[model samples]
Target: LDPFVDWLQKRKIPRGLGIVIIYILLFAFVSLAVILIIPPISKEVTQISENFPLYYEKIVNGFNAFKSNLESPENTEQVQQGLNSLGENLSATVSNVAGAIFSIFGGLFSVLLVLVLTFYFTINEEATRGFIYTFAPSNIHPYINSLHTRIQKKLGSWLRGQLILSLVIFALTFIGLTILGVPYALVLAFIAGILEIIPTIGPLIAAIPAAFFAFLQSPVMGVSVIILYIIIQELENHLIVPKIMSKSVGLNPLIVIISVLIGAKIGGVFGALFAVPVVTAISVFLRDIIEKKVEAETKLVQ
Candidate 1:
């Protein structure tokens, strides 16, 4: 939004008008996406619900057969206990996700508050920056400004990169699922794209329902779906992450994974969503401090 406004400003448009135009454009894009996407997703969800009984039957049969094959009573009991625990955990997770979604939609006041704040900040970006700088020591103002700029740049890059990554994953998953004749391709792909925000466990979680649906169709199809997910995961890890995320965050994969886990542990979904950017900001500050310390040490030695 800022970039678009800046472009318009460079083209001789007033900042006020530029902001209005950007807002209109943003609204239109969101409206168009909802209009184009909602119907198919609704239909897919309906179909899934209608066919859920059959899928459930297949799952039950598979589980029963596996249990029967386990001859040792003790092992069989352990497996049953594990399955029960898994079911309970899955139920709780689903409930939490559903609640979160509902809460987001229900919180109109919160959403409007955010929009209002964004508008205020965007219009007063420079004033806001100067105001913040007033709190810091006058002598270190330059260092503080540099640090702020670096953090803002990294965060902006990260946002753009993440959006690109999600879109790419969505397209790729939709195509793969369509080719494999999977049900609810759009919804599943959307899920995969959205979950791509979570670091290590996201893709794995996205694959579960996809593979489960495929397995309901056939064992071979299930295996194929799993393979497809693995291939996509590998591509994302090796090619996509390197190309898109490497320059944006400049954090190691291990750091990202750990940050996400910590964030999730602390604040659940929203924490995980923001973990990387928060870490990036902290890293920038730390790097600046380290550089300043090294310079001082060098000066003392001289």
Candidate 2:
């Protein structure tokens, strides 16, 4: 957005007018996407609701048969309890995910707040920086600005890269699911794309429903779905993440996994979504501080 505004400014456009133009373009793009996507998703959701009972019956029957075959009563009871616990946990997880999604997309107030803040910050970019600088010592103002700029660039790069990653996952998942003759490929792909934001655990969670639906058709189909997701995950971890996120975040995969887990534990889905950027910002500051300390130590030794 800033780059686009800068381009417009170079063309002798007023900054405020340029912002409005960018906002209009963004709104138009979002509108077009919603128009194109919503209908198919709605249909898929309706179909899922209509067919869910059949799927549930099949699962119950299968579980019952498995329980009947168990030789020991105690073992069967333990298994039942484990399954009941699993169901409860899964239910809670689904509820949490749905709530998070609704909070993010359904909350008009949140969206408007973000827009307003962004507009204010962008419009008063220099003034905002000056205001912030006023709180710090004048000698360290340059350092603070440099740190801010670094964090901003990293965050911007990360956001752009994440959007690209999600689109790529969506396309790949859609193509794979379609080729495999899975029902609700579009919906599943959309889930895959959206969940790609959560790093390590998201792909695994996205695969569950896909595999469940595929398993309803055939065991082979279920296995294939799982395999497809695994392949995609491998590709994402080995190829896509390295190429897309490495430059932007510059954190090891282990660190990212840890940060995401910590964030999710603390703040749920939205926290996981922002964990990488927040960590990146901290890393930038830490690096700067370490460098300054090392320089001071070297000067003292000299």
Highest TM-score scorer: 2
State the lDDT of candidate 1 residue by residue for 71-169, as single tens digits. 899998887788667656655654465466567566555445656776787788788878987897788878877777788777777778878898899
Cα error, candidate 1, residue 65 (Å): 5.3
**Candidate 2 residue runs with Cα over 4 Å from true position:** 64-104, 251-280, 299-302
Clashes of 2: 0
Question: Which ranges in model 1 have alpha carbons more than 4 Å from their true place?
Answer: 63-100, 107-112, 251-278
TM-score of each: 0.81, 0.82
Candidate 2 weakest lDDT stretch, 10 residues: 90-99
Model 1, C-alpha of 284: deviation from truth (Å)? 1.7
RMSD of each: 3.6, 3.7
Tens digit of per-residue lDDT, candidate 2, span 122-227: 8888898899988988998888888878888777777788899999999999999999999999999999998887667889899999998999888999999999
lDDT of each: 0.81, 0.83
